[model samples]
Target chain A: MRRNLAIVPAFNEADSIAPTVAAIYQWAPDFDVLVVDDGSTDATAHRASKAGATVLRMPFNLGIGGAMQGGYIYALEHDYEVAVQVDGDGQHDPRHIYELLDHLREDPELNMVTGSRFLASSGQGFQSSAARRAGIRIFSSLVSLITGQRVTDPTSGFRMTNRRGIELFARDYPHDYPEVEAILLIHAHRLRSCEIPVLMQPRLTGASAISSTQSVYYMVKVLLAVFVGLFRRRPIEAGDRPAMAVEHAL
Target chain B: MTKITLQRGLAIAVTLGLLLLVFELVRRKRLSERYAILWLVAATTLFVLAVWKGLLTSLSHDVGISYPPSALFAVAIGLIAMILLHFSLAVSRLSDQNKVLAQRLGLLAQRLEKAEERSADARAAPVPGKRSALPDHSEAEAEAPVPAQELSTRR
Candidate 1:
């Protein structure tokens, strides 16, 4: 039996943290839930712990990237074979975790599997605002063009990874608005990542992390990060990992 | 002649003042020796330029600048830029280390909590024959004991 972990990064999501943690447990009983309380001022840590999820309370806010990297580091240290990121705001359906896990298990070559809301099968899920959707489309096309694979939702945080992906992310991850750049990082390391259709719900509570005023800034920053990611040196070659090669053979 | 002498004296005085300020900061441990070296070099160069009447003029002429004072301005700007850039690099490194420290701290805290819970569980359900699952006496013994007189001094 493979060890599985669900990493939920939350910041002041006191209203939704407990239910989100519980839902992940309900949907995937085998997976150990680890909620990263990103220095929430509210009772998020307490509620998450009460919901039976192990909580790693950061001393201060390091944003989403730092929080998720903490979870990845924990997963790597604990030797979890598979780890899935479930947003604490409850936008990501926990049921889709199985689908992502199945993709990773089925294709050993696939390093990561992201749950995309724009897939045809995803249907009429909450697909963000029109402006953000346009931004997502631009990034989707850019990533698809660069990776030579179709990418519908490059900004989706709902993703699962194998140990190889875990090691890669644990070593190096971007700081702010990292989802799009993370995709480019996967490409840089010559790792395989694909998107699967998943229904996303509207935020259970609280507002979206990116406000209208910040959306323009977010778009420019992410685009710059992506372009810069192209020039970064590849830290790991595809053939370097003998362990992954053996696993693929099996 | 008197005006030129007064200008030279003022320049020398300002450079001397800067050197003394650097020395004072280093002596008080406010500025580190690593950074003090750069300031020392800057002050000494300014002192030389101030005392040497024809040095700045010749250097400016060699660099194709008509004005010697503007050449000094350029050099000062360059030095300031270098120091600012160095500070930026230090700040970037510090923030990176801070992030790593925070992550490690959070992980360690979680592990410590788990270990404490396990120990609490052990103490709560003590076995019959084994040594009681009390807190390890060795941990207490590891600390150096304060003398009774010293302990009572504050009270």
Candidate 2:
């Protein structure tokens, strides 16, 4: 038996939210799910509620950063032992959730585990548009360069976080392009992070917020945010072995 | 007594002076476009009345005095200041609205993250010993939380 919290931020996702919530019930029945419906013009909130998910409806849409940050706060308040972010568009495979959580549960120091479509390294289950994938790769490379860790899928929205990750995120989740900025944030806080292979389905319903224009903005803004974070981070305790190296050696 | 040309020249000078002050005020953000219009209108009208004192002064004084150009200029300046002050208050209200929107968005993110977790749980086999989340909900107490309680570092 396990106790976990899943944060699902949705907007105009009426078509797939019910099935996504239903799938979550199938993957981890013991976990409690909360829907942060960010002012959906559709019936996303009502459907999530009917599906037995606790709905936290925002008065207006605040994009991905605000939605995910809400989940971090909830995780902190309710004292969830493990927290995972599940996208509302039904792209993420909830089954891999157990895998991501398992890694964190095994080690107290490992605070963040993200689901990476590229971790499998087999190109299977990669359904994002070519343009989107190209953008993801660019950002992933940029994050890897900044953090000194190769994050194969920097934009992967699916993640499992420990108490440390939750606290850090609750404080300063990026307003947009949370995945990239969140990686930098995890590094800034001296938290350990890893990416695990996961299946991502093509969105069954609507368009993504990461449009052509948004992709350009996401790249520019996230890069700037990462640069600022590097300066803002408290001096990493001198000569402390990097978390990944230590975790891997152990 | 002053010559007609001299009096008319002074009236134009007073109007120009007020107009110059307005240009400076605009640069400092002390006055907005809408309010500036009223100031300019009042200033110009006073200038016209100053030169044609006989008609304006007939009621107020015996012959040569009217609402003096300089006095009317003072009133317009005061009106602009009051109008600008009110505009400042309006900007402050907008700032407040932006703050509230941001706070609510933060709360929404927390709820969405929780929903993602719940949805993940929906996928797995239901087991016993589940821990209660959202202690804010009274119903949470009845159902035990899952053994997978992964709270790594509690404060």
Instruction: Note the clash tally of each candidate.
Output: 0, 51
- DockQ values per model: 0.27, 0.11
Runs in model 1 deviating more than 4 A are A121-123, A236-250, B1-10, B127-155
| Residue pairs of candidate 1 with colliding backbone atoms | none
Candidate 1, residues B76-124: lDDT per residue as tens digits?
Answer: 7787788788889778767767777788889899989988987786777
Clashes of 2: 51
**Candidate 1 global TM-score:** 0.84
Candidate 1, residue A240: how far the Cα is off, in Å? 22
Q: What lDDT tens digits, residue by residue, belong to model 1 across residues A73-156?
A: 888887788999999999999999898888899998999999999994545788998888999999999999989999999999
Model 2: lDDT equals 0.74
lDDT tens per residue, model 2, B67-135 = 554444555577667667877976755643453455455555655776787757645635553434434
Worst 10 residues of 2 chain A by lDDT: A241-250
